[model samples]
Target: MLQVLVSRKIAVAESICSFELCSLNGEPLPPFTAGAHIDVQTPAGATRQYSLCNHPEERHRYMIGVLKDPQSRGGSQAMHEQVEQGQTLTISEPRNLFPLAADGKRHLLFAGGIGITPMLAMAYELSQRGVDFELHYSFRTQASAAFLDVLAEAPLARHVRLHDNAAATQLDAATVLAAPTPGTHLYVCGPSGFMNYLLSTAASQGWPAEQTHREFFAAAPIEHDGDQPFEVELASSGQTFHIPADRSVFEVLDEAGIEIETSCEQGICGACITRVLQGTPDHRDQFMTDKEHAVNDRFTPCCSRAKTPRLVLDL
Candidate 1:
């Protein structure tokens, strides 16, 4: 973890707080691509992932916006009420699980509520590349919209379309996604319900899975009542281990002195994604895209188990 100073803290919108972090040593920080996020060590002794909202080209500081969740998951509340400007904080280097398509010809970015954080960085990068892109930001009200000041003067403002539900600015997914142009990719980040409805609309329109991308802040709950024990093989030692129904593959491996770097063990982060040398995975992760999971080449060991009795891992 890197120690950084919280140089600035301000209210970006109703129930939303923005924090600016700077390297403690007064030097350029590690470089990160757009759509990257860092694991923050909150004041309440809990770790949470927040997307880097500032331009990736700016190495001086990293910016993150946090919404005061009524759910009180500990991270958001701590960031808003406990952390203060000038306080020092610890954070992991940025990791990207929702990066832009390298060769995408055109981009359609959608963000809802606090989901706008990563979209800010992505818009900056896309604008710099001179790529054709549009950013649709949806919010309940202008008073509750975050980063309005930034958008008002930001270079990417021209490419932005604000959709305020209070103003009756309806966003018709079917109309927007009607013409499926080849090479035009779509990226969306938002509340699960918002994403589900939009993606469902896109799917109904016959959009290819490869042409869509998304990032989830949390995973939907899954049932484990019918879970069964499974065996996992480590290719390096040809050693096998048993994974119980109650324990995850990660827990089983760790008990045997196997270490797998992980964050968000709930399977929202890709840190624990393990390559599958053999056997199919009972994927329980929300990190990988559906197309990625269908390939069955990698799975998050933290929450994913094997469909087969015996599965092989690259280790």
Candidate 2:
């Protein structure tokens, strides 16, 4: 963890706020990519990841924007009420999995609500590189949308279209995502419902899985039907253990005195990722891409499982 100070705080939008953070000694922090996020240690010791929303070229500081989540499990509320400017904060180094890959000549960007934060940085990076891209920004209304002022002045503003759900007709998915084009990449970040709808619609139109990328802030719970038991073999330690359906892999491992690092048991945070040396893993997490899971052979043990009667993990 890195020690930092909240240099300043400003209202960037109606429900969105921006915090300019820097090291207490004003030293340069570690360099980070455009879509990276830092895990901030809250006053309650609850760590929450917030995307770095500012230009990475700026060497002096990091900027993080937070939207007040009404259904927040206390983290957002504590940040708004207790976190003060100039206060010292502990933050983890930046980490990025939602990186922009060069798959095509043209890019279509889609963002919903606070999901616009990371896409805002991507838009800036693409503009700097002179990449052809367009942004489709959707929000409940103008007041609730963040970064409108800054985005309006950007050179890429000509390619951006903002939709206000309150006044204008809802964004038509068909109008925006009509025909699939070759050499065009689509990026989406939003609520689960919006993401599911967009991805399903795009897939129905014959968009290949590789042509699209996404980032999600919330993940639904994993559901299991019956109490089926399974066995897990730790490759490194050469130990095998039974994992009952009622208990998660992490819980069983901890009970057996096997140590592994973990943070978000819910799977939104990619902390507990481990390699699946050999097994058909019944993946239940949201941190990894379907392709990544298939090829990389990594799994989040906190909430995933093995479909095979016995599985081997490189823990």
Candidate 3:
């Protein structure tokens, strides 16, 4: 656990708060690229992941924005109500499941609500490098938009577009993702419903899967009412564990004294993904692409389960 001090905290929007964390010893923090996130150990004892919104060039501090989600399970609420400037917290090094493609000639970014956090960093990087990119950020209203003033003063300000639902200036995903251009890449981060709409629209518009990328802030609730008991075998140790319908494979492994690195156990993060030596996976994770799931060569043990009664894992 890397200890860091919260140097600053500000209300960026109506319900969003921005935090700047610096190394406890005043040393440079771990380097991170755009679209990277760190797992923060909250005061309430719940771990939460927040995207790094500061430019990658700034190594002294890591910045993140958090929305006070009403449905939060204590993380955001703790940060909002209990955490303050000068507070020290434990955090994980940066991990990126959503990375910008380096080869794209033209980049199109879409951000919805608090999803703009990662995009803001990407915009700064692209602008500094003089890359061709455009950002379309949508919010419920101007009052709810975070960093509007900051964006307005950015070097890429001319390419930034803001849409407000209350003002009837909503983004048309269909029109924006209508056609695919060679060497053009698209990235989106937003609510599940908003992301699904963009992905489906891009697919219907002939956008290649490789050129389209996305990140989810939270995993959609999955119903496991029909889950069944299954068995997992570790190929290296020849040890087997039985995972009950009510428990996850990760929990079963932990009970057996086997541990794995994991964040966002809901399958949004790929940290707990393991190679599958045998058996077909149910593939419930949103981290991997359809092609990766079709191969059935890898699976997230945190949330995914075996389609077969017994699964052989690389372990």
TM-score (C-alpha, index-matched) for candidate 2:
0.91
Question: How big is the positional error of residue 212 in model 2, measured in Å on the Cα after superposition?
Answer: 0.9
Report the number of the highest-TM-score candidate: 3
Number of backbone-clashing residue pairs for each candidate, in the order shown: 0, 0, 0
Runs in model 1 deviating more than 4 A are none
Expressed as tens digits, the lDDT of each residue in 1-315 for candidate 1 is: 899999999999999999999999999999999899999999888999999999999999999999999996798999999999999999999999899999899999999999999999999999999999999999999988999888877688899989998987867889888877899998889888878877898898888988998888878888998999999999999999999999999999998999998898899878898999999999999888788999999999999988899889999
185-281: candidate 2 lDDT, tens digit per residue: 8888878888777878888787878888887788785678864789999998899999998888899999999998776677766778888878788
Instruction: Tell me the whole-model lDDT of each prediction, alpha carbons only.
Output: 0.92, 0.82, 0.92
lDDT of 3 by residue, 10-52 (tens): 9999999999999999899999999999999999899999999
Q: What is the Cα-based lDDT of residue 12 in candidate 2?
A: 77
Clashes by residue pair, model 1: none
TM-score of every model?
A: 0.95, 0.91, 0.98
